[model samples]
Target chain A: MLRVKNLTVDHGAIRALHGVSISIEKGQLAAVIGANGAGKTTLLRTLSGLNKATDGSATWGDLNVLHSKPESLVRHGISHVSEGKSVIPELTVSENLDLGALWRRNRKESAQSKNEVVELFPRLGERLSQRADSLSGGERQMLAIGRSMMSKPQLLLLDEPSLGLAPLVVEQIFQSIRDLTNSLGLTVILVEQNAIGALKIADIGIVLNLGSIAATGSAAALRDDPAVRAAYLGF
Target chain B: MFEFVNTLLIGITAGSIYSLMAIAIVLVWRSTRVVNFAAGGIALASTFVGSTILEITGSFWIALPVAMLAGAALSAFIEYFFLRPLLKRSGDKNQEIFLPIIATLGILGIMKAVLHFIYGEKIGVLSPPLSDKGFIVSGESIALSPLRLLILGIVLLLMIALTLIFQRTNIGLSLRAASFAPEISRLSGIRVDLVRTVGWAISGAAGATAGILQTVNGSGAVTPEAFEFSLLLVFGFVAAVIGGIESLVGAVVGGLTLGIILAIILMYLGSSLVFFAAFLILILVLLLRPNGIIGVKGGRRA
Candidate 1:
């Protein structure tokens, strides 16, 4: 289980994530939907140790992840795939996937993880020799998620995976996310601007407005909620 | 035909050394976004260490590896003490690359002064380990000597090793990932700081090899104020720039092109035109392909 309480983050004086609180059970898929600059990315970055939390208590299986090094977070079975398709463009697709398992001491285990990720995204299996830069937007995002899975994370955080991708591509990516949570028993915290799509695939939905949580409920209830639909879902 | 062949031999021999230096420059640039002007200075210092080792052990082979080790240590120290802070302060801006370039130039000046202070009275000698007598072909001697062949072999081995490291290793992936996208790499759990230091170490070792080769290949001596060392720095940078300064393969091609042209110029146009011809070649290439011969087009300022 993951727990975040009274989390406040100030990005060089402009407070980004307010004193927000949330709890997520293991294997649960939690989608965070918000407007631009509503601190959705900030929340995930802080959770992943990319941003310093001014005040917060985030406990992941009894570990205080606040202010820890980003590398340390992955060791504790947590991984964050931030905004944009974040694969190393200069490296070949195989090399990029290899890096995700770098910290693991057991080479055989990382190889197993690589096999799993490749099984999940078979396109990566075909493009192993090609450079990551040659990948299309959808393919790059797939590589990014595939890389995160290479770490064999118990909990994964994704930000704007559907950004700039076509509707068909977005559906395919969200389907993978669904499969990850349902079959692999992986917990997920997804931050998205595509509220409707994210909510449709999500198990629970949390809405953020101006760096504060506006609503939280089951994905169906939040999708049906008139206030959430009027503001975020575009009812 | 003999004259042309001799000229080609001379160019290839000299170009291989320049390629070593250019590889060092490119490695440093790719890893830290700094041109590493101090490379020349550090190499000079490492040569002095090589000279000391040569005196103690009386073996060129032993001196060489020690010098390379000294280079790696000094390079890592500079990265940890100097470049890391400067980069963190500067961030990854195209314009900010100039800051480190200038900072490295300042470091170069300091290293020159320090080497002069330590070894000003007597210059260090690095005699060729192998015979310099050119191989005979059809009753005429060509420019290809055993020493030059040895130099070529060493450079080839290093390049091959580098290729393997970058293409087939995990550390290479981390270095590439960290350089290309630090925030993402850090998120992916790569120790970017440690990787940057390692990159500098590799660059330093390459620079040290260039220094030893450049010293023995020519007058067989090194001085803190030697104009030859400065020429190495300049030509290496020019070669790296010509190669597009981003890719290792580019560095090799640029070095060979610069070297062959200059050698040919010296053969026909006089030694005076060699430097002038180099400048002209650099200008022509840059004007034609601003990004370099093999540099990526429209990429970040590499």
Candidate 2:
């Protein structure tokens, strides 16, 4: 399980995330939905150790992850797939996947992880020799998620994986996300602007507005809640 | 035809050294976003050590490796002490433009003074194995001076080896990623500091190697004034910029093309007009294709 307590992040006096608290059980799929600058990304970045928390603590399995480095986070079973694809454009698709396993304690285990990822995303296996920049939007997102999985993280933090992708491609990606969580028993914390799509796929949904959590519940309850529909779900 | 073939071989040997320096410049630029103007200064320092130490021991081979090691150490030290602090303070705005460049200039002055202080103001000679030798190739006299050929072969092998390392090794992949986008590399578990350190070390080693070859090839001597060889650095920089700072192969092509052009100019015009000839070609190339012959169209800003 992962626990975040009273987390606050201030970027030069402008608060990006308020004193928010959240927790996730092992192997759960949770989604945070919001508009741009609503602190959805900030929450995940802070949780992943990419951003410093001004106050509060992030604990993963009794470890205070707040003070941990981003690299160390992966070893502790948390992987962050950053905003905007973040693939090293010049590297071949296979090399990008290889990088995700850079910190793996053992080479053979990491190689196995890579094989598993390639199996999950077979398109990646077919295009392993090609540079990542040549991939289309949907392909790049698959590569990003696939790369993150190469670390064999128990918790995957995906930031805006659907951005800049077409609707059909988005559907395919969300389906893959669902498949990954169900088959691999991987926990996920997905941040997205596609509230409806994210909520449909997520087991639990949290609505964030102006850096604060406005509502939280099961995906069905949030979809049925009139206030949430008016404010975020676009009822 | 024989004269042309001989010049081509001579040009190839000289071009290889330039390619080494140019590739180093590109490596540093790719990782740190700094042009590393101090490259020449550090190389001069190392060359000074190699020449002086070799004169004492009468062994060029031993002196060369030690000099390269000294160069790598100096580069690593500079990165840790000087560059790291400035990078910390600058914080992403191109504000770091002048700090290291200026600090490096000061280092240059200090190194020049030190050379003068230790070796005195006179040019000191270094005798390598191929000081005055030649090999016959294709019924013509080709100067296969062992030192010159060794320098060329070593540089080529190093280039190939580094390319493989960058493409095949994990550290190399991480360095390439960091060079492209540091924040992403850091997030992916790469130690940005260590990668940057390796970059500086490699740059220093290459620069030192170039300096030693240059010192031995012409005049067989080095002086405090010999350290004033910014022309080579500038030529290498031009090649790097033209080659698309991100492309290793581009650096090699740029170096050879630039070297051949300079040599041809020197062959036609007198030695005094060499600089003028170089400037003319540089101006022409810049006017025609400013980003360089092999530089990427729009991606990186090296």
Candidate 3:
């Protein structure tokens, strides 16, 4: 389980995340829905060691998530996919995937992981030799998710995976993410602005407002809640 | 006709050395987004080390590799101790490269001052390892010499090795990925900082090779304030820019083009016109393709 307690983060003098806390159990898909500047990205970045927290304690299993560096976190099976498209555009699809497994020294295991990633996103397999920039927006998102899987992470933190993507493509990506959690038993903390779509697939939902959690419950309960719908889910 | 062929050969020989220097500059720029004006100083310092090694062992072979290693060490040191903190503190903003450029210029001055203090008006001799006498072709001594051939061979080999490393090796993948996107590379578990240092080391080695070759290819001696070294740095920078600063292949093309054109100008036009010709050529190329010959259009700056 990943547990965060009173995580406080500052952007210069301004507090981006204020005494926020959330927990995600293993194999559970948790969606963090919030408006712009709600500190969703900052929260994920702090968890992945990209942003420094002013005061916080976060633990992923036995590992102290706050103390670890971003690179070290990946080694400990915590992979983060940043907002928008995160794949290296200059690198070919295959090369990008290889990079995802860079810290994995065992050749056999790395190859097996590559195979699994390719199987999960067959579109990626077809475009393996092509440069990532040449891929479509949806395809780039798939490649990013598939590349993250190459690390075989126990906890995947995705920031705005559905941002700027078509609704049909977003459905496909959400379905794939759901499958990842369901079949692979991967724990996920998905940060999104698309509240309704994210809550539809997430097992648990946390609504963030102005850097603090406004509501947390099962995805169905949060979706059905009148207050959450009116404020965030937009009916 | 014979004079034309000889000039072409000489141009190619000189251009090959410039290509190494250009490659060095390009590597450092891509990795750190700094033009590394101190590249010339690194080369000069390492060449002095090679000269000292030569004095001790009397073996050019031993001196060359040692100098390359010393260059690599110095470059890595500067990147680690100086540029890394400075860049971090300033934030990795590409538009703010002006500061790094000014900072590198300061480093260049410091390096030259240090070298001057150490050497103290003493000249370091880096005589050609192989025979400098041109080959006899139809009873005429052409400009192509054994030492020039060796220089060409070494430059070609280094280029090939670099290409293979960037294309085939995992470390190369990290280097490419880190330069392209440091945050994403870190997420992929690659130590972006270490990879950047490695890039600097390679660039230093390349610059060292160029320095040693330039000395041997020209006056066979170097001083702390050698004008030739300054010229090498300027020409290399120009070459890198002409080749589209981002691509390795562009560096080679830029270097060769600069060398050959300068040679032709020196031979037919006049020696005085050579320096100005470099800028004129650059402006012309930029006019045609603002991104340089091999640079991407509307690409991300730095």
Give the number of the best model, judged by TM-score.
3
What tens-digit string does per-residue lDDT give for candidate 2 at B65-163? Answer: 888898889988888888888887986565788677777677778877887788786676666656457676656557566676877877887887887
Candidate 3 chain A lDDT trough over 10 residues, lowest sum:
A102-111
Over B1-302, each residue of candidate 1 has an lDDT whose tens digit, in order, gives: 89999999999889988998999899898887888999999889898899889988999999999999999999999999988888778855865777888889999999999988988878899988999999999899989999999999989999999989977788877877887888888878888889999999999999999999988888889999987799899899889889988878888999988889899989988998877787887898789987888766877421
What lDDT tens digits, residue by residue, belong to model 2 across residues A1-235? Answer: 8898888999988999998888888888898997788899999888788889999888888889899878778778888999999788888899888888887747898789888988888899999999998998888999999888887888889998999999999999999998999998989999988999999999999888888888988988998999988888787
Instruction: Give the Cα error of residue A99 in candidate 3, in Å.
Output: 0.4
Every model's TM-score? 0.96, 0.94, 0.97
Error of 2 at B161 (Å): 1.7
**Where in model 3 is the C-alpha error above 4 Å?**
B91-96, B283-288, B300-302
Off by over 4 Å in 2: B122-124, B136-140, B300-302
When only the first chain is scored, the TM-scores of the models are 0.98, 0.97, 0.99
DockQ of each: 0.66, 0.53, 0.68
Q: For residues A142-220, could you state the per-residue lDDT of candidate 3 as single tens digits?
A: 9998889999899999999998899999999999999999998999999999999999999999988999999999999
What TM-score does candidate 2 get on C-alpha atoms? 0.94
| CA error at residue B262 for candidate 2, angstroms | 0.6
* Candidate 1 vs. true structure, TM-score: 0.96
Candidate 1: Cα lDDT at A154: 90
**Candidate 3: residue pairs that collide:** none
